[model samples]
Target chain A: MREFFERLGLMAEKAVVTTGQIIIMLFQAVYYLFLPPFKFRNMFKQMEFVGVRSLFVVVLTGSFTGMVLAMQGYNALKRFGAESLVGPTVALSMARELGPVLTGLMVTGRAGSAMATELGTMRVTEQIDALYTMAINPVKYLVTPRIVAGVLMLPVLAIITDFVGVLGGYFVGVKLLGINPGVYIGRTIDFVSVNDIFYGLTKSAVFGLIITLISSFQGYHASGGAEGVGRAATSAVVLSCVLILVSDYFLTSIMF
Target chain B: MVKLSAEAKVGIFVLIGIILLAYMSLRVGGMRFGKEEGYTLTVKLDNAAGLDRDASVKVAGVEVGRIKDIKLQDHKAVVVLRIKPGVRIGRDFTAALKTSGLLGEKYLELIPGSPNAPYLEEGEEITRVRAYADVDKLIADLSEVAVDIKKVTGSMAKVLGGEAGAASLSNIVSNLEEITYNINAVVEQNDERLSTVLANLEVFSDSIKEVAAGLNVLIKENRDDFTAGVTNLKAAMETLNSMAPEIKHTVSSIQRIARRIDEGQGTIGKLINDDTTHEKLNRTLTGINSFIDKTQRFRLYVGYRGEYLFDADDTKSYLSLRIQPKADKYYLIDIVDDPRGNRRTTKTEVTEGGSTRTVETTKTSDEIKFSAQIAKRFGDLALRGGIIESTGGLGADYYMFKDRLKLTLEAFDFHKDRNPRLKAGAFMYLNKYFFITAGYDDFISDVGLESAYVGVGLEFEDDDLKYLFSSVPPISF
Candidate 1:
């Protein structure tokens, strides 16, 4: 039991330190966003990787989620003679909640782990120390463009997801279920207000910042060999998902 | 020429990323920042069901515009609709709130009324518009009505009972007893009367057969007589036709007399038409009353013996009597007689062997009595039992009723298998001579079998027959 207590103490200490590091990293990312000498090329490359390249997976998840929601909602509402409401129900749920959160989780899995692993590898190999010795600022070089790309591209990805999701609902609700095409589209538009889409985009931007800062903090502090890089990658993905869910609730509550 | 700064690379990436992000946002979000490309029309709705900022507006299933914005103003929903600029809408166009599908969406559907009407200017309101009635509320009302129907049917069932309310406690026992008694009585009464009626029917049928046989023999024996009678009738008709001119002249003279009376031309005609004639007739009737009074004041009695008896109660002593008695200066009379009494006393009684049997007996008195009976005559006829009896001959009387152009035919006691007692005839009208008549009678032997007949006739009338014959001589002999 004493040993268990000691282990708990160590875990608590590590958690505190990690939390402080994440807060400091968030501040540094915000500071870099407004600073001069923004890296447009790296930002573009990162944007392409995060936004454009992520399109297929985002669209696939968004559409399948919307279609499944429509199928399930139609079955439920059909019992009450309200199967026609499936289109609007699926659209509102996707735009206000699922679109941003699901895209955040997806990009975290795809790009967040990659960013952490690469940075963690450089840390363990003393390459970050080498940049300092060569009179180079690693934060500006490695972090700024990724932070800019993430903040800019994530909201774009969320928008794409929202559009594709609504279309997916339209297909299932109208073409498959024989719901009137006009009614499906009109209900979707009427049910999902502009505020809902804007809120999701804002959530996505915050989630993107969280994902980058958390993954970079873990990677920059990584010690040990390849195993530490793997651990950092895994922890970054898991932590990004957790922060996204927690922040979504708070954001939704406030916005609504 | 060798080195590029890290900041430059980062700057380029950031700039490109921003541009791509902006472009993507504009494309995916469908954000159009410039001016709208259509004439705008605004419609207000209480509820805009599932309409959005960029929702398509359709007309007759054709996409023509988009919904620009939806807002609530003064507790009423207002939807700003933007139509394509080149599309011209007439002023008389009607806008109806329509649904995409059952639950899909709601949009304004414009139905153009008249093409010749003036076009609606841009940004003008469509004053005439209709909202969609909520189908959900209608369904709810139907369900409520169904519930009421169920309740009413349940109450009706209770009121009607299981056997349609036929049973009442008071009648149950008494009705059953009465029904049994009536059935037994009817069965016994039918048994008694059935045989008697059958026996009587058999006798009646035998008599009918005998009568039919006799009728057949009579008809066969008189066959030639019937033919000769028909021939005699034809000869009589020819002779009557030879005398028709004189008859026609007499008919014309009578018609002229009737016409003069109708026109109040002669003295009798004036009596029929003038009030003074009526007054004079009334005075003459009053004078006859005074003469009858004077005659009644003379009392008298007369008697005469009669050999014949008019009734079985009359005896051999017969007399004819007429008596009048005076009472307070007026005369009154009474008469009584038995004429058959005298005839009965004088006749001999005969038996079946044609031998007379007589016994000496005193003769009863028989009397013949006479009394005055006064009756007034109207025109040339007297009415009795709703039939007219004329002082003139039957022919003239017939003519007076049905003129000379009219023929009175009576088919009396005519026997046919279908109609034994049939009577049918036609009377032709004068001038136009179109006569309509109908007859219906039962067959004597066939019981209920009967025959009906209808007849039409023609006649001609002329005042100057000689002149008419001279003007149009016969074309064929």
Candidate 2:
């Protein structure tokens, strides 16, 4: 029991230290955003790759998720003669929670893991060392653009997801179920509010920051050759997903 | 020159991604940098489901503004909406968040108040807002109501068929069957009558059209005459108004007479109100029937002897009577006797026999035999029983009276039958009982026909009995 208590104390200490480090990192990011010698071109290029290129996959996943949600909600509500409420059910779920979280997870798997692997490979090949020797700041040159892109791209992806998900719900709810389109849309609007969308975008933005930081941190600390780089890529994805879920709850509690 | 390496490619990709995000943010996120040409308004809501900066704002379903900012102040959400110039709201405008489509992004919607009201100023806070009515809770409540309704209906079905119910179902079913048969018969009998009525209606419609045309012609030809008639009516009304007090006095006298009759104070009132009059009438009718019976018997007895004398000639000496009477006219009666020198003649007569006779002679004529008879007749009359009662109260009482009084009218047994019946009458007091009391009493019995009675009553009051008369106006006339 003493050992267990000691372990708990150590774990608590580690948690505090990690929380402090994250806070410092957040402050650094905000500070860097407004600093001189800003890399606008790099930021723009990263945004295109992350935001524009990932649009189709995000929309596809979002629409299917919405259709599946409607089907499930309809089945449950129909038992109680409340199938008409499916519209608001789908709308509120997507706008408040699923739209942001799902888009973050998808982009993290698609782009976050890829970013870590590319950077890890560069580190193993001594490209990062070469940049250091040339007196260029590696954080600014290698990390800033990707960080900016991830942070900015996520909200756009979330918006697209929200739009496509609604359309998917409409297809299933109206076309398939023969519900009046006007009533479905009216109920959706009536049930959903402005705060739900705002909360989702805010969550997406935070998730973007976490993904970029995890991928870059894992890549920067990579040591072993090919095997080590592969491990970093995998670990980056897992950590990013965990952080996203944990942060989502906290953000929701605070916003709501 | 160094060829672009994998690191550079990745770097460039990241840069591209950043630029694309910025562009999307500006385009799709509805981000605006410069001041827009609009008036800004703020609203505080307890909850904001999915609103954000740059969200579109609509008025009357038209895009009139966009959300500028959303922030929490004092634990409440403050939303700043930038409305377009020339789009006006009122003090009573309601702000609500609406989704564009199912699961779509939410936008701020402003419901404009009355147009005639003063417009809201720039930067004014809109206080009225409608929060989302929780769809899940509403659905739950509706389902609960439906369950309650089902339960009530089920209970009602059980009560209607229980042992102690108002009617035996079997009796009701038989009555229903009889009613169905009667309805079918009536429908069959009225088929030709209905066709005649339809024909008459068509003719009436044509006549109405003709009348309308004739009226139009008359109006065109006698416009002056019509105006003169109207003028004359107006003058007559004026003259009546000038003599109103005298007319009112005359009307009051007539009303007093009516009130006396209605209160059972005079002969007509007693005839209407007293049950003894009905009993006396019934006894009188019975006595009349008995008297008619005695008179008919006297006539029959007087006519009977004439037939005996007519057939006397055919008999032998010693006054033997032979009578052959019509069967339908009289009851059967017979007599036989014999009288002769040494051979006796015997005769037999029947009151109901046909006109045929035979005579025979006997050697021993010393013994004499005689026969006499009498008959009685009866008539058909049906008896019926019923009870009637009336009660009288303005305003809601009038409406109640109209409904209840009509029920009484459906109770009277004009054609009596062998059935027990009940009848009730209701009268409404209108204008403090100075108004008329109308009542109807209908006999409730299974007599295959409905009988109804209607009567009007008036009430009176003196200083000593004013309160009693006012409260309990007698409802019979």
Candidate 3:
């Protein structure tokens, strides 16, 4: 029992230290945000990397997500003779919750894992150390642009996701299931509001910030060999996903 | 599989991204582009259920605008509506929150008021607003009415069913029985009066029986006188019976005489049966029938006319016939028995012997005279001008009630030295085929023919006139 308690204590200590390190790293990244060249070249590169490149996967996920939502909403609302509500149901889910959440996850898998792996490889090869010796602020040079790009592009990606998701729902509801087009679009406009989309974009921005901070933090702290880099990349993706889901709940409650 | 960099095509990809974001912001996020800014109006609503930003604003049940924003101010919802240009909203317009479809999503409903009201300017708040009714209150009121109906139905059931209904029905039956029993008691109380009436009736019947017995005894005593009278009647009948043969002979002779009459053998028989007499009678009948036929075409008015001569101081009477063919045309003929006749009279006084002697002279002799007129009717008035009593005259008639009543005026006996005699009379039917007439004749002429007279006359329809008018047989082709 004493050994078990000791091991638990060690685990708790590690959790606290990890949390503090994450907070301090986030502050440092924010602090470096204003101190240097704005890094538009790097920021645009990351934006293309995060937002443009991830579009295919995000769209695929969004379409399937919306079709499933339509099918499920049709089945449920039809019980109350409200099958016409399927469009608004799909729209509200995508604009307010699913669009941001799914885009964040897909992009995290595509860009965030790539960010961790690449940075981890650079760390293992002593490139980041060499940057530090050459009087370069690595966080500003590497992390700020990535964080800015994530924040900038997640909303763009979410907007695309919302559009494709609603299209997919329309396909399933109106074409496949014979719902009236007027009822589908009318109910969507009647139920969905701008605030829903705005708050969803807000959640995507937060998710982007989170995915960047955690992925870059894991990459910055890499110590082991090539195997350790893989672990860091995996942990970054897992942590980013977990944080996204957790923050989505709190954001949804606040916005609602 | 391959690497694409932002150094090439990044601008285009980013541009596309921005464009898509703007599309989503304007289309999916329900925002508007800056180039198409429209007019805006605000509304303060009491209760705005299911209202959200970017909801549609409708006018006359069609979408004309969108909700720009919604906020709570002082516990009331303040909504800004962005309306497209060229769509006018009156100041007295009203806004309400209504479901788009039954039990579906809700939207803001705007009522464009009459054009006479002021136009709604941009950013102006509307005053007329209707909030969603509280469904719970409506249901509560409905339930109250239902409870009242239930109470009424329950009372009806109580009256129609169960022990209370039975008790009331029995009570009504008992009251009826009691009323019948009271009537029986009242009949019993009048027993004495009823018996007295019965006894008086019995005594009167006994007196009548006594009178009938006395009459029977008187009849027995008069039996002998009745038999003697019957015997006398029998003797007279015997005398008649004995003369039957002579009477039979006389009847045979009369039969011969009747046969002779039928054969045109005697003067009286010839008078009845001769073809010459028959021909004469037929000619007379045809002439009379033709006159009757002419009369049948007319509605006849018979009037008694009297005239008083001022100089002669004598009254004359005449019977006049007015024949009306249609309501509008008539002919008048009068037979006058003039006492002073058509004469003009004069009296002169001469003082030859110191005593004045009056000498009367007549300018014309008394004569039987007549008047004739032809009238043409125009609505209620008719114009008549013709010879009247051997002189030219003019007259008028006013008809009433389909000519059942009339007032007539005849100006006749016109003279240069004297005014024309004007006769006015009112004629009315006392009954069908009978009339009474009253008139003053010569009211205007001072020399003669001025008199008032009233008389009733029979308007006779010749008995043969009916056959003459109706005897046209059915024409054969």
Among the numbered candidates, top TM-score falls to: 3
Candidate order by decreasing lDDT: 3, 2, 1
* Candidate 3: residue pairs that collide: none
Write the residue-wise lDDT of candidate 1 on A1-256 in tens digits: 9999999999999899889877877677668767777766776677767676677798899999988888888889888677768977887888788888989999999889988998999999999999989977677777766777788778777877777787787788888988888767655654556567778889999988888877877788888899999999998899989999999999999999
How would the docking of model 1 be graded? incorrect
Which regions of candidate 3 are displaced past 4 Å?
Answer: A1-5, A37-45, A79-83, B1-4, B28-60, B64-98, B106-135, B146-173, B180-477
Candidate 2 C-alpha error for residue B121, in Å: 18
> How does residue B370 of candidate 3 score in lDDT?
75
**Number of clashing residue pairs, candidate 1:** 29
lDDT, model 2, position B104: 62
lDDT of 3 by residue, B77-178 (tens): 899889988888898888888886667566888877787997888889888997666686589889999999999999999786888888998999999999
- Model 3: docking quality category: acceptable
- How do all models score by TM-score? 0.41, 0.39, 0.50
lDDT of 2 by residue, A1-256 (tens): 9999999999999778866765565566567677778887777767766776687799899999889988888888777676778888887788778988998899889888888898899899999999999987677777778888888778778867876787788889888987688878866765566567678888898999999888877787677999999999998899999999999999999998
TM-score-wise, the better of 1 and 3 is 3
Error of 3 at B366 (Å): 81
